[model samples]
Target chain A: MTGPPDDETRDRIDDELPDGEPPEDAPDGATGDPVPVADGGFADESAEPHEPRIAFYGGKWASTVPIVFFIFWAIVQSGVLGIGDTNGLVIGALVGTILGMFLVRGDWKAYADTIFEGMTQRVAATAIVAWLWAGMFAETLQVGGFVGGLIFAADALNVGATTFPAAAFVLCGLLATGIGTGYGATVAFVTLFFPAGVLLGANPVLLFAAILSGAVFGDNLAPVSDTTIVSAVTQDADIGGVVASRFKYAILAAVPAFAAYLIMGSVLSGASLEGAAALRESATAPGLVHLISMGVVIATAVAGRHIVEAVSWGLIVAVAFNLAFGLSSVADILVFTTTSPTPAAALPFVRVGETAGVGGSLYSGAIGFFPLIVLTLLIVAMAQIMIRGGGFEAILEFLLDSVATTVRRAELTMVLGTAAINGMITINTAAEIAIAPYIARLGEKFNINGYRRANILDANTSALGYIFPWAGGVLVGYQVMVGPDGLGEQYGPEMVVNPIEVVPYVFHGWFLVIVFLLAAITGFGREYIPDRISEEVSRA
Target chain B: MSRFEKFLAGWSLRSSTPDYEPGDVIEVMVTGAEGDRAIARIGDSTLRIEGAPGDAADTRIRVAVETWDETAHRGTGTYRETVGESAF
Candidate 1:
């Protein structure tokens, strides 16, 4: 009786409503005509059955008020004031959502239901799952002294390897871009390359920035990237053509960013050669065994396995390596210590310690992202509210009717509009999805080809997601730097880079944004609908 | 276009209003509709399609161009058939 209604009761309930549409949270292709969603907007009513929409006091524009306030709050908190505290962002999102309820014109339940709809969205869930698994893997490697191993190996090999920030940039960029995951690559690189470079006399801030830049490079161009796919599909363009057309932009930014990292790497050698030599003494050969574990993840991700599966494989391999090679004890990787461990002391993961706690790499790794994950969910909920309430549509309509009267103005509108949305919604892919319809509609209006539209949509989304302090990519990377058990306590305070500090140094992110702006103004990469047809089928 | 050509595409400057000749059959999305007419705005060029369904907005349809004025950047077309619907 306390549960959801039974079939018979549900039928009765459905029959009672005038339109027979329930007020359930079906934001994503749910029971009714597909209303706009953060990932995909406005499914054809002729194609799908839709739910009744929740109305606001002032039409669709009213739906965006709460999110608009939240963005203003974020701008004031993170951008204008330079406050990087994520918890503050959480409070901002909460207050913003509360503000939304007052704007609902009809039953408040519809508004409440939309919150649940957004919270349950697959986009938020995907990020949470990947962050959790990646967190554990990162910590386990740290426990195994993977950083020290990298330092010793780089020192012995005498090749640049982890000693050079430029090398780290290239490697991290290749892995992330190739695999289509900037966040995952950032975690892996920060866990491996960040400390290795730090100990080998590279500037810690520069190293972190290089890793973030690498992630931006990959996320913008990766065919398998969610942002890329969303941009392509929403714009009605083939993924292959979109990728091909955007190549020049990616490379244009990358080449200079690469040189910047190289020059900056040498000039900003914050650590002494003597200090690096002294630090390498702490490393041992056994620690290097975890490279196999690292390889497993990079390989699986490149093979296009689900991120969860790839990280799981990496976790398994790392644990096995730690056990077989004696790099770390079982209790160190996963220990369940209780007030009285007598009963479970015999268990492999159970150990008697002075303090009673769940202290292990896996546990701590996942624990680090708790605040960030909460913030991500709340932010995504805000994006969903905007979509359901018509704020997204309002923004697009404004751009189309008010700003984009000419061809040049239209392209500029696309560039600035995408940036504004990505800037507001901290989750890059969610932002891209939410803005895809606008991009498609507006770009189509001007006959701006799909390749240019997709490129514009993704480049801004990818770059902004990593650039901002409150952005998911930046926060996720910062969490790892905070010693998300994957890298360990040995990393300490010196290696940590505040999310704000890395902003200027994320060379590729800035470079990419600059390229799009230039392209828009000069029409460098502009194409028309008559340019050429994309492939027959949608690659995405 | 070939793989190598993709890298070379869009090198030259493109016009604001592109022209499509008469008898050209093109597949385009009907972005909006007014009364009995449907519109497909390509770049700065506008195409008014005839015999399009009332619900043609946001749906892809095939059209045969009837006439085009290059200077005016506008054209008229006859709707052939519905090709697809909006992706979302």
Candidate 2:
């Protein structure tokens, strides 16, 4: 009797039906049939789940692709099968592209379009602008004899040779901060200050290490830096906010490094102070006018002007100082800074000096940026193709679904990821771009603030780029140590510090990595997440 | 125009446009698409644009957009023009 519909149930069913035909109001699976989902899942009734897209070369290629080339390049360059200089980046790109062709599902034409879009668009524009201005400023300062001036300033202070490393680090930090580039600062220090330190009988390896440390400090902090820009923009934080948020961490690492350098200077070397006569003769008081140029740039930056505008103002000030102080002629400044210079005719700018003038300084600075800009564009294009073709998406999805879950782990992973990439690439700027997206997305998943993310990305990238053996900074330092006029060749190999030997001496780099790790573990800098204001206003 | 020229022009937004001399402070209906509408203040010399969405309309404005904290979120969408510069 209960098997049949009860009177209450029958009444409820009838009440639920519309006043029209019952057939029109029947359930989806009525009429002695059941509806089937398209993909056999409850949600798949209307659409399919989003599957992970694959690239032409899976991420396995990022590992093996570089190794194959490493083997080949090692054989060719070092005449050994297993041993070679780290030339893995070129190989990685080539092998990755080839592998991509096999696994990527997108049309070949889309891949081509993606490459062009990546190469010529965002990265290229940013690179060109940054390198051009940075080059100009650096060259101008050099031509203006800023480095020589710095030496003069140091010498007059009666500082002993033993204390030079500590002093150099502070000065180098300031230079990098002023110029807004760590790599540029490193190059400048190597060319000018490195030789001077060797002459002063300072430990050459220690000296080079100091220079690199200083560079890292600046790159970590400078508002105008590429890494800084990348960090802020990717994390959606204002520049000032990012800098402020990271200030405590940077200082935490920096103070210890400074102290270590001072102590090491005391223990490893003794002061052979230069006499006043020697100091006065060697030192050239950097004309007050030259410092004016730097002042203009700093003032403008602090005043919250746009970067381009600030740089332009700095350029103008530098040019004025060059002419006003009779530092260099206009023609010299122009010819030196000119791109695509032809040797057919002499430029009028060359007439003012036996060497080059302020113009040449500007020109050299601008030209130096060319290769970096090209590299940035090419790398960006390659990355874009990988992304648009589903390579990036695949990697990102895997990271999200399987790898990144907790905030602490995600932050640690980001720091380590940047360091790992930078070690291989040896180019901090390029490395930052390749890994920035993943870091940002990971932070967002955990509701991390833009400033914290930017801080971690830059600090780690800056540290790793100089510590690795294959890094450009290390190579240059090593070359200087071994060159004919270099410290090793002049005095002895004992006097010159090879980069391989100096790695152990690079205490700051090692310390920073450890500090960052500890910071991550303790979650000290992690509280700045979900920043309520823009980077500009956060600090203010 | 040449293809290259057109391409360059597209990227170089600050250049090519006629210089505007300041008269009365004017409000221009920021033109784009829906969900991204903004009103820009046109001063004598500068065209201040927003990096993000916000309430302030002086020169800079911040807009709220969904972006991952780790990656760059490029906001590309349509914004209808809400106002135009009124010529006195």
DockQ of each: 0.37, 0.01
- Interface C-alpha root-mean-square deviation of candidate 2: 21.2
Model 2 docking tier (incorrect/acceptable/medium/high): incorrect
lDDT of 2 by residue, A205-294 (tens): 677888888888887888777778777776666776676667767777888888878777767752233342454355466443556776
The total number of steric clashes, by the backbone 3 Å criterion, in model 2 comes to 29
User: What's the i-RMS of each model?
Assistant: 6.9, 21.2
lDDT against the true structure, per candidate, is: 0.75, 0.52
Model 1, span B1-88: residue lDDT tens: 8878898787656666678999999877776654568888776678889999877776778899999998898899999999776544
**Candidate No. with top DockQ:** 1
Query: Taking the tens digit of each residue's C-alpha lDDT, what string does model 1 give over A18-78?
Result: 3655433323344455433211123333332122255566666677776778778867886
Model 2: lDDT of residue A539: 24
User: Which prediction has the highest lDDT against the true structure?
Assistant: 1
